[model samples]
Target chain A: MKQSLTQIHEMWERFPSVQKELQDVLFIIQDSLKANDKEVEKALLDMFRAGGKMLRPAFVIIIGQFYPGNASKLKHIAASIEMLHTATLVHDDIIDDSPERRHAPSIQSKFGKDIAAYAGDYLFAATFKTLAFHTDDMTVVRQSTKLLENILTGELTQRTNHYDRHMTLADYKEQIAGKTAALFVLSAQLGATNGDAPEEFVNLVTDFAYNVGMAFQILDDILDYQSTTKDLGKPTLQDVREGVYSAPLIIAMQNKPEIQKLLAKKESITNEEAIQLRDMVIASGAVDEATDLASEYTEKALDYLSQLPEGESKDTLVAISEALLERAN
Target chain B: MKQSLTQIHEMWERFPSVQKELQDVLFIIQDSLKANDKEVEKALLDMFRAGGKMLRPAFVIIIGQFYPGNASKLKHIAASIEMLHTATLVHDDIIDDSPERRHAPSIQSKFGKDIAAYAGDYLFAATFKTLAFHTDDMTVVRQSTKLLENILTGELTQRTNHYDRHMTLADYKEQIAGKTAALFVLSAQLGATNGDAPEEFVNLVTDFAYNVGMAFQILDDILDYQSTTKDLGKPTLQDVREGVYSAPLIIAMQNKPEIQKLLAKKESITNEEAIQLRDMVIASGAVDEATDLASEYTEKALDYLSQLPEGESKDTLVAISEALLERAN
Candidate 1:
């Protein structure tokens, strides 16, 4: 968490307004999580304190600046965007049966799924409340809620594809397109449109954001195979055991016979087998292949960023995109 | 489902406008569940068609009639209220590990908790989307969202008390106050105040709604002990097994050593012991004691109702309250 936090601080060191907006975003998030119930409050605050990169909220702030927008309004929206992301992560942990998040016990595992479920549900209430309270624009509210639907739909689709060793790279792309890219595209779109940015600018930034999100997710999938549990802030290769075929695994199994046979057994794949499968995939050089795919998208994102009128906002977008690519976890 | 529908249709037969709003409420709910993803939409729609009493939405429509509220806007708010209730029920089933709802497989049971969790999350999006779309009043949006927080807090509190054999009747009341009555009060308050109803009427109706909700919950608890699975539309006395002490169980255990001893084992209580506990609670006069307590709330609700100016709206609320009291399931 501090790794990306330091990166973000240095990257935004020159932009005082963006920093202020981020502070306000944090304030709004903290305020929203406060509850009349003590356990509810603590459960939610613990998750908040778990120290995510706050990357999505920062993306919202940075993108909002591409065109003129109200800082106060932007901060509240940014907070809502981040809260929605956090809420989804909480539920995702439960679905994946993940015991850890951000290097600590996950809400589901620590608090049990009962409190954790309520925590996620409560954050959702806070998410929309902040969004609706900040903006009078019904379009923004409507589209924001739809973004949530899109994300959950992506997750459900991913769930439906579990345990299929033959799951294609094409299917993986489609899943992340919904789960990851849609939010990024919207964060950028909302920021640009709220400022009344010209149509061309809005379209370009949204596309840029989309490509960036795709690349970000691919790099993340690679980290699962490459990074340690400490670095990743959670167990690695959990997705593989849970039958979620990430890009590297999907590509690796295409030519590897033993890998396919082990995964074919699904959950019956022993822990030792899972470790061997991970090693085999890494040895098969699918990690490098996945990195290449991520680079392609990063290049595409930069291409879109290049077409934008040169300014501080464009410069900041380029910096953030580069940093995401360089992330080890 | 048909039982309450027949009663509502007959009760509102004299007031066509109220019936029209209720019809529009259904339309809005149906529209909100329509999703871009087929699986998400199907899961949500199946839950919708599973047939709840539509009691909460009806409360909104019925209470709105006390003051001349705009039917169009009122229908939208009513729909959102019911959708929120449905959304909570979806999560509740997951938390309780309940297999059935309304005599059919619950969303969580039929679809599994992953889809069920998303379905609940999706409905929340729909809930806020519907609310924000129809009203310009930010207060309404903020308060409606807070209602969600209150409900979740109640649920978390209940979770904290799980397996406590010595749980009190007062504790049960506090839990239900947040879990059940808060929503009821909000429904009535929104209905009254939205139409520019007099404060005196609004206060009376909200109090009336609160008392009515308390009674409604107590009656529900009593039914858990008294009703058959087929009649209750879910397993009877499942709460006892789950360590959720309802009114009859709480009161019965206060004096019955056997009831307390059986509950002390918590989850280790054998299935046969749970059956015996349920039988003992029923054979005890605690069911009648719980019924008398429900009667007290019913009387208090009527006292509040009597203070309201004589009108068709008042009449409808009275009928609904009476019908709720008389329900076996």
Candidate 2:
């Protein structure tokens, strides 16, 4: 059964030790976004305040807690990861022409696409600046840089294959691996390395993160079809509208011949059409299948965690993954 | 007088040693841009072949030649700098809505703005990847990252003040310093430091590059008013049309009340109005003033070159700056 919001909040409350660290990460991000240009600064601040889950940073801190590490350095790496994620979102908003993000006007909608584009670039530069200035480990820095390259390559792949209804399940997996899993792996790897974890532990945590990220994204795509705009804080059926056929849609098309015909039209679907498509996807039980796949990945992640010694850090990591499985936003 | 294209070619011919290295840099760039997505690779390759002056890489190589450094490493750094530059151009073209670049269709024009935006981002990620993977010096990496931050800040400033006809000459100088001179400083500093030049030499070459960069941008802005589209490889009067009052326009508005009144309208200037504005800027002798400033900077750059040990590298540096002073494109 999906956890309720109260349950998710309770799980978060259990991680009070990292709350202060998370706040410090927020401060670092805010400082990085501050600029001499008031307009740019304001735009960035507003976007930051729109409030994300900051799951990547949370993962970093939680994983880092499993070993002895400088809390401050962990916060810096976490902040950098979050900034990079935000940068990608800024550009994604432009490409998707998204009007709202986190229940507020997106950067592109509020400040025009040009500013949105520059804001994304600014955040990217800030991410590197933070890493270069704060992180002492060149190996960590180099690995993070490689992850960014992979992330962008994934984005290019998605862009090139935009609206490719013929895209296979394997194609979807590859895209998400680069787009989503790479950062997750980076977050865990950085946390472990900084925490002075052994090499085997680092590898284990990285594998855990990859599974968790894959599940997380799969759940996210499922939510797009299941949740309301008010609940998700953004529009629904966006993936299909944008021609990005996610797991649910791809799975549904196999069983629902009508879906294939609908997707084959290659034109923008109307509100009625979108509703019909969503209903068909849900009715075809593809959402359940995708959710099951997500659960399987989440189970794999939990299995990896079970290999480590039992501790609060491990418990928090498990709880976070479980909450992600039930997360509505 | 501005030099002819033939003169620029002749100046380039003075540095045949770096030409082979430059080709290697190009190959690295091509390899970096290659992706599983053929369309993206092709677009990037087309942009590369459209041809740039490759002045930044040349600057890096020429400065590196002054000391003993790994040739391949120097080439990597040069390629990284050039890739960073090309990335900026891709974004700039989108922001400017430019149709042509280097006498060919721009990425935005050919592939659309979304793809253009991603291409720019891809290049930036590739740049950092190359630096992290190949360049062992963390200080150089940090400095380059900081330079990118400053460059983006400059871009934000320019965008915020897009058509501010009241922008002071000082403001213009500061903007160009961040937007243009910062990268030039990075190029020279990276080359000198990697070449294992002394601290004093690095500082001196960096300062020289700053002066040269300032002069180059000033001359570039002046040429937007003085040259034709055929000579420029893109539209002429683009700055004024886009409400980007460059050095000549800024200087002209200072002394000519009519020019100020004309510019204060704050709307996109029609071609006829652009021609009139160009004529007014020329008639007001602002072009001459801007030209004099460029020449002063070039002289200062040459003075710095003279202070360095007499060598072929020094001569090539001097030639590059002199060529820039009279360059039409």
List iRMS (one decimal) for every candidate: 1.9, 1.5
Return the TM-score for each candidate structure: 0.90, 0.94
Error of 2 at A323 (Å): 1.5
> Per-residue lDDT tens digits of candidate 2, residues B1-329?
11111112234566777666777788888778766367877777777766678889888988998986988889999999998999999999988899998888899999888788888988888888788888876786788788888898888888888889788989999999999988888899888877668888988998899989998999888878878888997776887777777888888988897998887666666778878988999999999898888888888887887888788888878777776786522
Clashes of 1: 0
TM-score of chain B of 1: 0.92
Q: Model 1: per-residue lDDT, tens digit, A1-329?
A: 22222223444556666666676677777777766467667666666666666778888888888777787787888888888999999999988889888888888998888888888998888887777677656677778877887887778778776887778989999999999999999888888876868989988988898999999999989888887778887765788878788889988988677788877678776667767888999999888888899998888998999999888877777777887776522
| lDDT of model 2 at position B126 | 84
The deviation in Å at residue B316 for candidate 2 is: 1.1
For model 1, the docking class works out as medium
* Number of the top-ranking candidate, with DockQ as the measure: 2
Please report, as a residue range, the 10-residue window in candidate 1 chain A with the lowest summed lDDT.
Answer: A1-10
Chain A TM-score relative to the true structure, per candidate:
0.93, 0.93
What residue runs in model 2 are displaced by over 4 Å at the alpha carbon? A1-11, A327-329, B1-11, B327-329
Looking at model 1 chain B, which ten-residue stretch has the lowest summed lDDT?
A: B1-10
